[model samples]
Target: MKYKIVNINDTGVRSVLIIYTGGTFGMIQDASGSLAPFNFGKVVDRVPELRQLDIKLTVISFPKPIDSSNIGIQDWKDMSYIIEENYAQYDAFVILHGTDTMAYSASMLSYMLEGLNKPIIFTGAQMPIGSIRSDARENLIAALEIASAHNNGNPIISEVCVYFNYLLLRGSRSQKLRSSTFAAFESENYPVLAEAGIEIEFNYAALKPHDENAQLNVINNLDANVTILKIFPGITEHSVKSILSDPQIKGVVLESFGSGNTMNFDWFIDCLIKAIEGGKIILNVSQCIGGEVEQGRYETSKKLNEIGVLSGGDITTEAAVTKMMFLLGSVEDVNEVKKKLTYSLAGEMDMMEE
Candidate 1:
């Protein structure tokens, strides 16, 4: 895919590549007063403060920007490809994506790009950049600064992260919890990696360790034959059966009630058992925003453990789904996929205490 590059700041200590993926961050209104992707070539004109950052800025925008709602596996591949091709040239990357699916993209990239040693900060806005009160300028500026931040020649943030509002969260741990506010993302089960205020206060203890010797490996083969089945109070047997019985589905992210509890009804257990027997790797993740999936902590969830349903401890559904896709497509062995599903591949989940 061809990209249009726009140079913002030419001289600085560090260079940051701003990936302009279609989002509200680069939007403006037309004469008809409808929001659309603006000509990102003039991004410097919209957010002039970029000139003030001490980092050389270059933007690579998609030839035809798309809404985050339309982002799919191909988009993820494109983003990864861009990073892989430019890995050695740039010190950091700032991805301007729509907040709606920014968490998903970030989580997916965390798994796809292994052994990353530079910051890949994802940021977006709640309103168009054309709006007088839009948060786009602040978010972009902070993200760029955080991306270029380093100490003694080592990058401060060496993993995928989402910088929104004033919080910097691990990409895999973040979820878009709000729809209409600038504070649209949160990491309920993990600590904020950094906070932007008078200055960026980084939680060094929360940052993921990086291996400087390791090279970036981009895994592009993602299997999309995975789906989520959320259990509700009155979820029907038919619903369970239909979802589990899909022939094309290879993995299922079971969004179980608090702490992985599910109905103990014979039909429900039978459906789960049947799915497991059919060689479907089911990952049990909690539906709650802040809790974990304790597969056998209670009698309600004990059956899941007995049936070989894997526990996704404190993992967001977005991460669980993308992890499944990453494992299923990249790993040829189903047993290996099941093993990796329960472990933290890219610091996506907490390690279960044995």
Candidate 2:
């Protein structure tokens, strides 16, 4: 699972470990014109420009490359193991992930890798590498360059980030917005951390400064007994009841309307009350891309605050769902879980007024 490509022209270059999980970025077409996963050991041959970046590169590929949609809890665990095992060997890490679930995986990774002191970038391509006008070369090359980036003898970026389509977004803050176009990801509520043009321009003030003395911790215990219920007009109490009917369900991310407002119906409120009384952790998140969940900003959401529904301020559903998994796995007390969800755990949300 290990292959090295030494840049010929550069001397004493920093190293980057590329973890290829599976995606269009590493695919090639055969005589039948169907896309197939390429042997990553031969990647340098497809993208010769890797030699010019002058970064010592090593790769570790999954035994079976899967579409981003197929990524699961086990895959997340395996990816963490790779990064943990090689934490000391490489300057930074770049994950070759599929575009479909890249944001979810990246957001989950942000929660898993707490107190990070080096960059863990996730990037992929809309077109296959073997295509005449493939974006894989640019994306992978930029990712490598950013991974090796350092300033004042310290790394420029020391957190989990998603570098895609010329922008570098905070991993948990980003969401995949498009599937057909190259502009597939966006961080609507947050500012861009970095951008690549003629040069890679970084917003230093936006970058989360890391504590070099802190320990690098990777979280593996995530409780997947969580569900997301997006509230729409006329969403039945029956549907909500059915979802919450399972006694084993630990947490739910209620994707409500703007500013966390929901249908202010008696049955709806009663349903929520029953769940909260049943010891279920219900987190309120705004369905809008650019706003925070203000629990008491209006009459509809005031009940959410009155009934112990936790407000997830401006946190995307990607982060909210995964955050629930992380918190539920670590803490057993429901009140403590509610407290943790109200605050920023790894910059996933703004510290909302409780």
Candidate 3:
């Protein structure tokens, strides 16, 4: 990947680095007319809107851009290392990622980069840039503008965020909900930090303010020994037991039926109890797209609570998985990991007040 310095005429401009990590936004048609990943460094020529922005821009492409479906812990580490290594040299950072796992990457990056006082904006498009009606140009251009936006000589947004369609959302709180529409992501429980219209209207109170004195630190080690158990009607105990008893599995996300309800069978309770006793961390999250998990309200869910399943209130699946990995990496004791799962470390979960 080659990078060149591009100059802008507007004054008060700062440099922002756009890191391209393979996605639909960077895809182009080949000779056979099949969509394939293209070198992102060539995007500037295709989308001239970038030149309209006052900020100086630089591009960095992953040596081997990966499809979002194939993204893993190693990819997360690689992206974090780039930001960590270049934190001081740039004013802010923008990442072009696939929408399929954009929320997961954004959430993981939020936890991995602690005390970060610079903007880390993640954006992508559902359609390729070469298409006639591509949403890529606006998303990419606006992301750069948001990343470079400053107030009182400080970056306006100091936290990790996702910019898509016309809204800016907290990275950890967003999820990709649509497949064919221009508005492909949503922040279920949180409000938009900023909205782009004729003019960008920033909700001042919603933005994460910069803490100039804080030093950026990256948590590179992520544990992948976690599993998700999504509950459905007629789920068998044998299937559940096999997953829990797996020697390599260290954490489990139990996606319970609406509001964290589960089958109250004796064998089901016994399997969960044995798993908890064996030091496996179990977290109960609601299956509904917009509700919080309430584990002790019903008889079925009460069994889950009694057996030591932690409740994940109003957390998206993407946030839950990354949070589990984050906790698994930071904590050494199994008890501590369980406790932290219930607690909101990066504002990933909304805890109901007593």
Assess every candidate by TM-score. 0.98, 0.95, 0.95
- When sorted by TM-score, best at the front, the candidate numbers are 1, 2, 3
Best by lDDT: 1
Query: In model 1, what is the error at residue 262, expressed in angstroms?
Result: 0.1
User: Tens-digit lDDT track for model 3 on 256-285?
Assistant: 888889898888889889988888898888
Question: Over all chains combined, what TM-score does candidate 2 have?
Answer: 0.95
Clashes of each: 0, 0, 0
C-alpha lDDT of candidate 2 relative to the true structure? 0.87
Residue-level lDDT tens digits of model 2 in 133-158: 98899899999898899987788999
Comparing 1 and 3 by TM-score, which wins?
1
Worst 10 residues of 2 by lDDT: 3-12
Candidate 1, 1-354: lDDT as tens digits: 789998878989999999998988888999899987888978989888888889988999999987999999999999999999999999999999988899999999999998798999999999989999999999988898899988888899999999999999999999999998788999999999999999999999999875689789899999999999998999999888999999999999999999989999999999989999999999999989998998888999998889999999999999999999999999999988898888888888998522
Q: Worst ten-residue run, lDDT, model 1? A: 345-354
Model 3 steric clash pairs: none
Ranking of all predicted structures according to lDDT, beginning with the best and ending with the worst: 1, 2, 3
